[model samples]
Target: MIADGLNSKVFLAPMAGITDKPMRKLVHSFGAGNIVSEMVAINALSRRNAKTYRIADVRDEPYPVTVQLVGSEPKLFAESAKLVAELGAYSIDINMGCPVKKIVANKSGAYLMTEPKLAADIIKAVKQSIKLPVSVKFRKGWDHKSVNAVEFAKICQDSGADYLTIHGRTKSDMYSGNADWDIIAAVKQAVRIPVVGNGDIDSVYKAKEMIEYTKVDGVMIGRAALGRPWLIAQTHNYLENGLEPEETSITLIKQTMLEHISQLQKYYGEKMALALSRKYVCWYCKNLRNARKFREIYVKINNTEQAIAEIERFFAENGSDIDERS
Candidate 1:
């Protein structure tokens, strides 16, 4: 069952630099059960860093806005969690699953998995500092040789974390190889609180399969939602009504791309929007007939109008009817 006040069981995972405000808004609009802000560093936030604060902004988005914070110091976690609660976050997620070398070097992210007592202390501090529901997202363990997710989950539960998200990979694996669902199932059985299974759930079938195989309370989609925000809605529909999703139409795809551009432009001004649109353009047009060529051209564009014009031209040349308004 979903947590109280949450609408669905599918969640959009917190991807740093990718799940920004515009992306979160788009995915939430597409009916993702919950959306998490990109992981913000507690040290930067406690220092009132402008860029960090900007990235953590969740004004006017959907309910249950979960702000994810990553850091090693328990005091900083407490301070940042209080700030996030004051900023109207519905929940606060401690990010212990990030596998980046830089993050781990700072004694944060998956590095905490190696120091379970420290991880538990941070969770307790954050939970004590805020009224918002506290959750922790972590990996299986430090490495393949030491898989400690079950022990870690128990530590988090005992420390007052209200929920847990487990990515079924060790820190050493990074994003390579297959995520061990058995590990996630083990975590679920070990913890009484809701456990969210994450990693490699790139399709609706995978989402359903993970839910059934692991008996997880939910599934968190990360890389899969890059271009296809509708996947969240489609997965929700499939799970709730047993409806299979059809291939998205070209017309709808173009419209979705246009809408994404519009939201980006509104959030970040035109110039920054144009720059940011390049990656998303590549994601949206990845399967098109001339995707490589389209990406080459998209990367060279310097303005929003030029980006929009190229998108229209590209789709029109590919035989899709243009909906300029979208």
Candidate 2:
């Protein structure tokens, strides 16, 4: 069973290529309840692919770390779940919500919404294969005409999934519109297991509204967290104590960005870190004044020292008007 002792109700969604160790560490430091690893392909994992193994690594993250697995085969899911358990994962999350074209074409991710039997079998197999809590993340349905999240949630619960996370958009929607919290609320009403609501939850008020509107057990934040790791902390504090969050200073934001890059450098080394830092630096500076100019310089940076120098200079010059989005 999933532990009920989580410190907060704010969770960091498992975003591909974005929720790596450095990002997870930064979010966890700011008090996220649980952090999930990027989706690991079961087929690649079974072959012992080095890169896939690294993607599933959670050795240094905080407790209650979850490893999310994506694939269509039950046996492979069972095997991968066992491997994740062996690697010390506290929970296993099945990825049935991804909307990527390649993943859906492979009968994984949101495609499973159209194949409930296989989805249930995969959940059953993983649950029976390990002692860790098993959860599934999925969308409303395959498309507008086939909204089956309520039935899907029931199937997963009956098949032994410990919890469910429902992203309110359908596979066809692909994140183009607002999430339907009412549908999520329906799923919660239909299932006995805990349900987490995810999609477009970018602010503390929205987080609060989701919990109240959907009556979900928790809220998951994905894209909104790209530039603001402290969002989870802000939402958690707001939910716990209804108090307005204190304004974060520009200095603190710059320091956090520096720390984020420094951690990436330490973990991935200077060269690889510079490559990775480019995208993150863009997100961090997305709200700064002269952001376009800053990104132009930052994205072309060839070394860690140069990247760090540019970050410091940019923040020093534009520190007066921090983005209010945080």
Candidate 3:
């Protein structure tokens, strides 16, 4: 039940398509307690798919990165866990919390919450396949009528999970509604192993509030950090030092935006990175003056050079050294 190599108390939650290597690298650079990979489908990784393998690569990362695997079959989960272990992952996390319809329909993700036996089998299989610490991330249950996070927590512990993460919503809730911290608290109370609470945590204050309320070991932040990667480090510093985070300057924000695109270009190549940078720009420019108008022109951009120039021009026009949240 002891989780080693998980020394930090604030972590970045795994978001599909959003928590990629570039994003993970950026957040890690700012000092998060830990970061989890976007859910890598066990089926693809077990088959040695190039794209999936690339997603699972964390060997070169200088942080404790847990590679999260999602799929229905326990055998494929075992194979993928072993592959991730070989790739030097800090740990292997079985993703049973994702609520995407496609994932649920495949008898995976939140659907696993409906079948505790199968979920236990998956955890056992992955545990037996790798020497790394094992963790399970799951929701309260499939629906409100079926809330079982407390029971599920015990199952995860009995099946050999070193720790657990419980998002406060159910599969039916998806990402909507207020997350029920009561269930998260219940899960923490039920399990002897460490539990990290997730869902609806957007600020360092809320992160501290959730830990205090649920008594979970830590907090996992998701969408709230999309454009604000530094929030993770801010939360960490606040928790460890009780110091309030300083207001980030517009210049540094622009610099981070530039660095983000550069990292995207390095990992995904020029053309693809240009295309992908559109969403990132949208996230970064939120609430800024002319943000909507600028994004309209930005996403249509096709050339990498043009995209970089636009970023430079937009940031320059906004301001250089002040907080310009309009």
| Per-candidate local distance difference test | 0.86, 0.87, 0.88
lDDT tens string, model 3, 1-326? 22787877887999888899999999988875688899999888877899999999889888889999999998888888888888878898899988998998999999999999999999999999889999999998999899988999999999999999999999899888999999999999888899999989888899999989999998899998888999899998988889697876777678889999999999999998988889989988887778888899998889988998888889788775333542
- Across residues 1-326, which tens digit of lDDT does each residue of candidate 1 receive? 54555567888999887888888888877764688889999889988999998877676665678899999999999988888777767788999988898999999999999898899899999988987788899999999899999999999999999889999999999999999999999999998999999989988889999999999999999988888888888888887788797777787678888998899999888988888888888887767777788899889988777888988898889845322211
In lDDT terms, how accurate is model 3? Answer: 0.88
Candidate 3 local lDDT, residue 262: 94
Best by lDDT: 3
| Candidate 2, run of 10 with poorest lDDT | 1-10
Number of colliding residue pairs in model 1: 0
* Candidate maximizing TM-score: 3
Query: Where in model 2 is the C-alpha error above 4 Å?
Result: 1-7, 321-323
Q: After superposition, how far is residue 1 of candidate 3 from its true place, in Å?
A: 12
Model 3 ranges with Cα > 4 A deviation: 320-326
Q: Which regions of candidate 1 are displaced past 4 Å?
A: 320-326
Q: What value does the lDDT take at residue 63 in candidate 2?
A: 65
